[model samples]
Target: MISKTTIDNVFDTARVEEVIGDFVQLKKSGSNFKGLSPFTDERTPSFMVSPVKQIWKDFSSGKGGNVVAFLMEHEHFTYPEAIKYLAKKYGIEIEETQQTDEQKKQANERESLYLVSEFAKEYFKHVLFKTEEGKAIGLSYFKERGFTEQTIKKFDLGFSPDSWDAFTNHAIKKRYKLDYLEKTGLTIVKDDTSTGTATKMFDRFKGRVMFPIRSMSGRTLGFGGRILTNDKKAAKYLNSPESDIYHKSKVLYGIYHAKQSIAKEDNCYLVEGYTDVIQFHQTGIENVVSSSGTALTPEQIRLVNRLTQNITVLFDGDAAGLRASLRGVDLILEQGMNVKICTFPEGEDPDSFSRKNSLEELKSYLEEKSQDFISFKASLLASEAKDDPIKKADTIRDMVVSISKIPDVIKQEVYIKECARIMDISEAVLFNTLAQLLQKEQRDASRKKRSEKKTMEVVASEKKPVEKVDAQYELERKIIELLLLYGPKEEDFEELILETDEKGEIDFKPETQTKTVFRKIYLDLQEDEIEFTNDAFKELYTAITDRFMREEDLKVDDFVKVLEPEKAHAVTDILMEEEKYSLHNWERKEIYVKEKKHSVSQIVSETILNLRRELINQKIKELSETIKQQGPDDEQVNLQDVVDYITLKKLLSEKLRRVV
Candidate 1:
């Protein structure tokens, strides 16, 4: 269990912008910074970070959160893990009391997988440098590939011994369970049918050079292994099979290293393998990644899209594989990204080419060869067509299909015109073909979705209806915005109240001051048991209450920083949604009343004060009823006097203009 003091300390020290900046590259956009949405596929940046409020919101995906929340959402880290990550980054020491074995056992499965992966990484690193066989084989292989010591360490290149039981034995010695090892696909399990015997095993990446595949946040999700020996039977490269923690389609190799550079340059250089990324990055072209030798997937494209919309694909000109890879160009365009292709000279791939050139020379070579996908494809197809009308029509249809895949109408129109110019065809003809393709695809997709829905209906008999999301959140958001902006100050206003007790008496009471009234209204809200319906609003409310109860101070700037990212974003969005209207100097803004002028701030304070006063009076009346039921106790009367005097003093203070 972590103490409240520790949690408070974590909140006090962690800055939302600073923490999120580690993973997201944000450039200044007005009062806030904007970056590609980390949660969605986007061509233009819609992820907004407000430094003033220390919160971020991705308008594209509606995923916003404080720093801790970002880690929780993006990296799948728990609250404690996020706090620990921030503490480590900022060099703050953490103090923990203790945890039971059961509590430790209850830790999430994904986190345990992460822990296992992290442990394996360290073990492999140790084996590579510390063990004689690992040093001779793994270290030599990497060095022979022209990898520097720094590069080898940066990528955590490692070796697993030829012995089948080497990793399994070591893991067991560490008291790590084989169940998780098998679950993560790090170990293979076998059950003998004849003998009715069962045995767990490890075979996924045995006896190979290990390449760790990391997620966007730099945590190892899986491993890729390359066999050095010329084994005719076994495959050259083997990757970890799909597991709970790793999905090949959803991940891209080298993303963790290249994310910042991609955002900085607003472009990602795509290649085709693990070595390509390493070699390119070593050559100081840091904004490069690979599809890890898989077919280009939309999910992979989206990963790159989150960092940049401009992609330059590097290919080996001599290889037939280059022609085969051209399909990915359309995939890139389909995601509404700017696609450029740059092929190396005959007989050189990105790996060899990068190794042979200096950083400046490589950059210059790429600059000179880079061409947009449209021109490159048209010119390439033109040669294949050889002025044959039939082949040319086919080529035009292919281009039209690519154009149809673009989600943005404006981009689609622009691309159609460019394609027509390049193909020397009429824009109308190309548009007609594109429209046909788009319609076909939409109908096919709808049919497929309906078919899948039928299967789901059979498996799940019923579905839960979405509950109506209350709009009271809007009101709470407005109130929080006002509190954050003007909680410290006071304002004057008028109020209406019954002058007499339950017996019908008349009395004089003063209007509530703005700050005081806000507080009173805020407390009355608690008494009335009204709750914020928005999840983010609820989070913000809890944070506000925590701060208010602890410090007795409400600094909007400070409180927003303490909230989760989503809540912080909700607060910030509301605060900035309205246009700035100024009452020049001391000209007060008015609120509508019974055909009379009322200052806006004064009305707010008065409303709060009146609500709180009404609540107190209600409580006093209940006590009076109880007193009438029995003989009056001196203690009860004393408490009543205290309440009455406090209310009278509040009214008098408002009348004398002493508070507001």
Candidate 2:
């Protein structure tokens, strides 16, 4: 229920680049900022943000919008949440009217779960600060572990007491539903057996220090809890079970806090635990996130890929620990990202090392010790292999397997050469091994997929991502492009018609005229009774006609903002895509792009007339089929229909000929 005035204030104050730049690594590209698409796994940046227009277009995902739209898309936020987030970030005060009872009841189930998770985070933090047990155990433990008060507050660290039903009872008293509490894995629900009348519910993270896991935009999705005791039967660390809003495979710990830093530095340091990430950031390495000791997933790798392509994984120094993380790091390599390894001294982790060393000393150690993936993996394995030929062969094969995971052919080839030089093996041999590995992997995949599907597709998954562009769609896009780019500009348009001379010969008669691009196109299409067939383009066409008729001038930003999200996205794609041609300035090189002033009539007539001709041609084809279906002895009405269709076709053909 945010007021429209508040939303406008947020829009006016928030800069699109500053907002998106927190989540994306944007490099200056002419007047816009360009970065890899956060929505797709792309190496070449197709995501473009225009400061002047206050809009962004991701050609890869076909998503484009203003600052609010980007937040809603990137953060999975509702409309009001997006507005409030921007308002808070830009220091704009929000004015919200109270919702009616019916309006409050309209909140969806997914949003309820989100509300529950957020409530749990606040409750846990309150316990840590206010309660006696929390202060003695949770706060004391964090302080003893070298976390300062600022760090604790920055991360929203919290505590869950040992008492069962403490959080559950509190949540219920606050009008939260138990269904959502259990769904988010914050409370455990148990059924009574013999009595069957009573149900048991207990706190899930009791007697633990809590770390709230957040999405990239800082919404609490789940929690990671670490136990303070060394109970032999219990697991030390427990995380919130998977829920509707939280998929562990898709979430990265500390991503919310580290996203801006990662983009600012243009590099990210991959660690293994929450404490490791916090300690690193505290010691001046802000671009860091942890996998929370879980194996890295492709989804998690792609989350980091939006900010930077380069990753320096800070692994434990032990040989076994380094070897243990190889498979996980391979997932990073598979995403077409650059990978480096920086291990701490023996028996030290990122947490210990960062806390012990000065900021400059820690940075120097990282810079001086970091090595590329191939070299790091080679030397570490070689030391373990010693002079054993079998061990060395195993090491070589392992390195080859990792190299094959790289999607970039050129990067794979470069790494293969380096591996060969380091392992002292033949490049051909390693290349053959890589080919064998890929072939076997492909076969395994085919068998698994074939088992599930009765029929196998001939096309590969990679080939299908690129959709085929239809001719009609391209033409429709071109029309919109022309109207959006040059609609307001006035230009000379020659008028020409085919005429007959005294000898019955065809001749040309041309007349000079001038009009705005909008007026000429509108009149041309209106005269023919033509309408765009595509829904998106048709909607745009209607809006354009209405605006040009009512307003003294046409403006793109106001027009784009009024369209629906999908239509707005399409408009932006067309506008931003066409900018490549519109913004291309050859005058800088002393070579001017030739103007088409004399051909303006042809350009305008062709765009409208060709579309009309296509529509007529389709009608003619339908009439021919209808005539074939009916015999020559058909009804008089059908016969008349055929004759009229033929006449219409001939007239349309003559029009096409005249234009030529």
Candidate 3:
């Protein structure tokens, strides 16, 4: 367990924007920062972070909380892991209590997988440097490839021994579980039933140089290994199988190291392999990542999209490889990002070219050689078409198809005009082609929707009915919001009291009481025995009230830091819900929005009265239902109860100045 003092230090030192900015690209928007939501695939910016409140809200996915919650949600870190990550980032020493055996076993499976992967990364690095076989094979290989000792260690490069059970035995001997090793694809366990021998365990990356594939946060998720020897029966390069931590399609090589550079440069260099990324970094180009030779995926592109809107894909000079990679450029355009293509000299790839050039030479060549997707595609296709009318027409149509993938209308129009100039085609013809492609896409989408609707109609009768709004739930949520926002502020509240007029009749009068807002709310709810129906709200209410009982002053930002993840998320959602309105700077447009603090007393009194009225209406409803199933004697009693409840509700409505 992390000590409380250390946790406080972490929260105090870590800035919400700085910590989250490490992962998402944020631009200043009024008082807060806005960026594309990392949780959802949206082109528009819906994620906002408030520095004053020290919280963030992703309006797209509805996930909101403080710094630790962002790490927990985005990186899927355990609570302790998130704390430790922050402590490491801010350079705070953590104090810990020793864990019992049971406590250690209680860690979740995902965390266990992460621990095992980290262990493998360390073990491989130790072998690469400390063992003779590793030094001779792996160290020599990297050094010969022009990778300095600094670069090799920077990437945590390593080697697996040729022996079948070297890594597997080492991990198990150190108390790591075989189950996790196999699941992470670091070790392969096979049954040997035919030979009547014990099950065979082997290292998956045996005799291969190891490259650790990490997440954006720098956690080792898996490995990619290259074979050292020519073995006709084995794959030349192998990657870890899909696991709980690694999905290759979503993971980019060198992303952990390149994110900051990508954001700083406002451009990302996309390549085809791990060596290409490392070599570019070695040549002083830090803003580069690799697809690991897999086709580019939208998820992968979105990862870079969070850092920059510009991508320069570095391709080899081979015609076949260039054609294959051109399709990925359309995917980037579809994401509303700018794409540029740069190819190397004949017979040279990014790895060899980068290794051979000095930092200055490499940088200059990239700047001068890069071309926008429009010019590159047009010229390449024009050469291939070569005076054939049919092929020329096809080439023109192909450029239009790529232009249509862009989401911006102005960019599409600009690209269309440029394509016409380059391909010697009429602008009108290209516009018509773009229109036809877009219409066909929309029609196909509509047709798919219609087919899905027909399929859904068959089971429409079995679908659950939509639920009506829960008035009590909303009222309870408002109560929590008030407590969180103005809990410790002193205010004069109008408490409704029962009194008698000159005649012997009952009347309601307002009695003024000065107290803290939290105290007022606490007394009212306790007086009525009201409890929140929503579990999250209920927990938050209890937490806030308990804090008020123990302390005179409460800072919402500091208070939310100590809450459990779900309750903290609930608090942020309630607190920042109104902050969104202020994000648009409506007040600057002469459309001033009213501040809630100005009428806190009225809002608090109305909320309590409304809650009371809602509870009475619920009781009246229950009595009415009881009246339906009762005998004559019971029916008269239930009817009288309903009548009394209605009278109370009417009085409450009158107090609120609302018509029933």
- RMSD of candidates 1 onward, in order: 8.0, 5.0, 2.5
| Number of the predicted model whose TM-score against the real structure is largest | 3
TM-score per prediction, in order, is 0.78, 0.85, 0.94
Of 1 and 3, the candidate ranking higher by lDDT: 3
How far does residue 502 in candidate 2 sit from its true spot (Å)?
Answer: 10
**Candidate 2 residues 48-133, lDDT tens each?**
89887778988778788877789878887788999899988888999999977677567888888899999999999999999999
Shift of residue 441 alpha carbon in model 2, Å: 6.1
User: In candidate 1, what residue range of length 10 has the lowest lDDT sum?
Assistant: 578-587
How many clashing pairs per prediction, in order? Answer: 10, 0, 0
lDDT against true structure, model 1: 0.75
After superposition, which runs of candidate 3 have C-alpha atoms over 4 Å from their true positions?
A: 98-102, 195-198, 457-460, 490-495, 510-515, 533-535, 582-593, 623-641, 658-660
Over the stretch 1-660, how does candidate 3's per-residue lDDT look in tens digits? 999999999999999999999899999887889999999999988899988789999988999999999999999998888999999999999999997878867888888899999999999899999999999999999998999999999999999999999999999998888889999999998879899754789999999999999999989999999998878999988999999999999999999999999999999999998999999998999999999988999999999999999999999977775776799999999999999999999888999999889999999999999999999999999999999999998888888989999999999999999998888778998899999999999999999999999989878868898789999999999999998789888898878887777875567877888998898989989998988888888878888888888886678789889888888898889988987775566778999888899989889989999999999988998998888888999899889788777878888888888421
